[model samples]
Target chain A: MLAGGHGNSNPNTNYLKSRGLWVAYSIGMLVLHLILLSIPPLSIPMAWTLTNQVHNAITFIVLHILKGVPWIPTDQGATSLLTHWEQIDEGRQFTKTRKFLTASPVLLFFLTCFYTVYEPHHFVANFLSVCLVTLPKLPLFHKVRLFGINKY
Target chain B: MDILEPMYTLVFTELVPSFHVHLQVLLGLLVLWVLFKKSEKPGRPGKAGKSELDIINDWKPEPLVTPVPAKHRGLNAPVTKNQIAQHITVNGVKCLNFATNNYLALVNQQEIDDVAVAAIRKYGVGSCGPRGFFGTVDVHLELEEKLAQFMRTEAAVVYSYGFSTIASAIPAYAKRGDICFVDEAVNFSIQQGLVASRSHIKYFKHNDMMHLEQLLSEQAVLDRKNPKKAAKTRKFLIVEGLYNKTGEMCPLPEIVDLKNRHKVRLFIDESISFGTLGDTGRGITEYYNIPIEEIDLVMSSMEGSLGSIGGFCVGTTFVVEHQVLSGLGYCFSASLPPLLTVGATAALNLMDGNPDLVKELNEKCDQLHRLLHKSETLARYFRISGCRLSPVKHLFPLELKSGTENELQKIVDLCLQDGVALAVPAFQLNDVKFQTPSIRLTVNSKLEAQDMSKCLSTLEKTVIATFKPTSTS
Candidate 1:
């Protein structure tokens, strides 16, 4: 199977199921917050907001926008039309990885709210960002694309 | 900054019960992290005592056996819904099938079907065991005798599967420390055989005689240096009759000449050519009018022309008899079903009776070649390939910049809509780094000139419509 280089399919799902993935993700979130806090002008609240927002934006692009595994041709364009989120666990929901992924953003949002003291502006930004990451993970709108954006 | 005292009080009081799942999740994550660290502890670089554990951890097992195709994928490509024929139903739509390797157009033959039915009643659908066991049905012997008689060889052995015929036949003779000279464009079956043989392989450019000669000469120089070892080592020259990758026919006479000069065993895989080439459908040897005895080994699959399930190898009794024990698939795997064996025997009987069918197939191939190559209409769009009378034809798009773009697939899809089924298979043939994917169309004796014309016109319309005329033109 390695005749075609790098035979791994859905590398994202593989990493998600891996033991240290959530720990690494939490550490990454902490690292992002620390980097933002190190800025001279930023307060802890501002850093928390920025960290959640940055994390959400990256996740939105990666899990939602990116479609198909580029390394192997095994699936024969089966994953071409599917986003990474839709491709996860072959579209099965409520699996451990999906639950963890769903829980992660919500946990980050809770932390952001606590750090920002539930400020209206910070709450809105974190709420929208968390919604962006987690709503697509819902089974209701699993493969539904609104308004044909990135539909191709 | 303020310490957010209200948030701490809120978490301790109001949200404590509500965050039940979260507490368990955090605890689970921490435990998982600790477990992950412990699992990785053996791999620390400074440890000298744990080399054995490191080796076990690092080892990634390669697949040693072929993964049984997941209850799908027939012997060849192009999964069909109904009985395979010139016209096939794919995804509920019947289209003129130019995809399958059914070259002799032996489909829906009442006689062949009758034989299969009769045999099934007598011997059941399966032989149930390998050839040495109860697998050796009466019809299996009959088919082997028929094949040997047809090929004018002293003996023949039938393989339960088409691909296994070549894969097993090669290693039965050529073993480790032996050498194989193979053509570059040979299909995956031949490649599998070469790999299984564990023989030193030297691949020459596809059908390049000079390169083959040069390799032979280089081996000769090595032989001069070590005559004792050279005398013990057997040499094999392997080539496909009509290559599966490209439809290009190997120059058999020249190849035979080379085999004689080099004193190498000439093994020709006539899988696609048998029962499709020559006036009498006797295969590549007959096409060139060369005696069948000249080739040390001839392997032909019954799936293509004979319209059956298995494959067979023809040679002297001494050579083929070795495969009964040495050929892995022959001894280990269940033999071909009695009905399929009877089916192949009937198909051969029909071929022996009807020489006109083979002639008709060649004529159809010629007409296709003429339409695609003689007329300059498709020249801008494609580079026509294969020998003049080759049953298989390829249309490699000259205009397409990259194979990944798959303009050919779009054209195939559009043609399929117009009732013309074509294949641009992600062929498990040849390496992909430099090879351009082409539309593989197999010509059958059953297709009339008008039907083929309609197929080509649909293809032309689709090609023009899919890509810019100027770009393709």
Candidate 2:
């Protein structure tokens, strides 16, 4: 077990609770972005720009909130877990692969944003697509184990 | 793009026109407020009503083990105002100082002051940035080169502060998986460095080479059991050239022999011994007639012996160069001020010019040791502890009465009242291992024969008065 007691036996319930909270946070952020998009003072391009800004702001705030939640591990906790696992060769390799997999969605979202900046016509589609891509990377959702298999 | 254009126009021209931006702002604020309010409510279902502050208020801090006296609660009287020489004014009284580390009494030397003043005029007080970022002035390089030359090493690296030099150097090379064999009686700075390294540390009895060898043999047995792990693990032996806590010199010859026999790297901290030990004062290596190249690294603080404000590590070029990129404090902290570096440079020049000063300091240490050793009054109350050559001496009580430290403090207070200054060695409360309460006296070269006699007379009187013998029935 890690210092934070992250390797508890009741993984299924903990994973579900964390996944549920992450889903709720992601939906709340999406609704906030949509509301900013529907504002009358913003033109189509302006609305799209406002939506991306709201997306970043809401994600940051929600991640901070998730850090305080017990079931979801904070970045510091994850780093400690990485260090603990690094003592063993197999576990170190596992952690490295897990980190790369975990980072892919955020990397993809930034790449999509970069391309959408030059082609503004697909801005709304790109924004929604990025939001969808980020869902699996959320604090709680990232911890979810499917069919008795741990994803992280 | 075409479908989105019509949709964008419809939303902007028709749908969004009915709703104002202000209302949208208010709606967004309301949603955020509700979300935050929900989060502010406790996550635990049963404890939703209690506020966060209420939980924090219920928490209590751990009580101190030994509560400090109310009179000593705040800052004590400032110890440094004028130069830390043989005589210093503390709380406006000129007292014979036996406390400061101005061993050679070069803190207020005319030549050093002149050079410092000149350097300040040329380069300002502060370095403004770390060494990597425009902080490396010419004086810093000069000091490093001079230090390397003086210590007879291929290269050396200077640290901005004395304490961080060893702390950063240890971790820079010895990472988590490595093993370190340390002496228990090393000063706090070395302890901090060992902690920072995160390496497997096995502490032997202080200055006990037999115990150290036993530990090494046991480690060898463990290594033989797992040959692959042993091959990968880097072993290091760390000891102080002159131990500050116990005020004794390390047996360096045996340590060097052990280092070769065990194939362990040797790192010696010569903070107290540098410019204080040896005939000409190159350090323990010179004092013991051991070649400097045998030791993997030699670290010393310029503050103690050189009467300056920084530290340096002397080693081969390859080892010293690694610290530039790896040593955290050297890379992160602002470089040593140009004035202080130049001051150290001047002091080095003085030592180089007059090697007799080092010789004189050694003679003074010996004289003071003999004077204290022969005092009947001191012999009745306390046992003097330290090497004859070490300037720093410890007076450990022969018998520990329940409140011996308080009694020692009373003697120190009385000595101060009588115009003689002494120091009570203080350690962190967490460090329960080597906390033998003793009065520490520092002997300097500037002290005349009469001055030593006067200080010894005052100490004898104070100790006798504090711990007067009671006749047995």
Candidate with maximal DockQ: 2
Each model's lDDT: 0.80, 0.74
- Find the 10 residues in a row with the least total lDDT in model 2 chain A: A80-89
Runs in model 2 deviating more than 4 A are A1-152, B1-68, B78-81, B469-473
Pairs that clash in candidate 2? none
Query: Cα lDDT for residue B461, model 1?
Result: 81
TM-score of the first chain of model 1:
0.89
The digit string of per-residue lDDT tens for model 2 on B175-247 reads: 6668999999888888888777778999999999999999999999999987766876789999998888888
Runs in model 1 deviating more than 4 A are A1-152, B1-80, B403-405, B429-434, B469-473
Across B1-473, the per-residue lDDT of candidate 1 in tens digits comes to 24667767756666444544354366446434433431222234566576787878988999997676663223434456978687888767789989888888776899889989998888888889999877898788999999999989999999999999888888777766789999988878778878777779889999999999999999999998878668768899999999877899999999999899989999999998999888899999999999988999899888899988889999999988878876778977999999889889999999999999899999999999888776454676788888888988888777667543357777787787788998885655444322667888889889899988988888878877876654557
Error of 1 at B190 (Å): 0.5
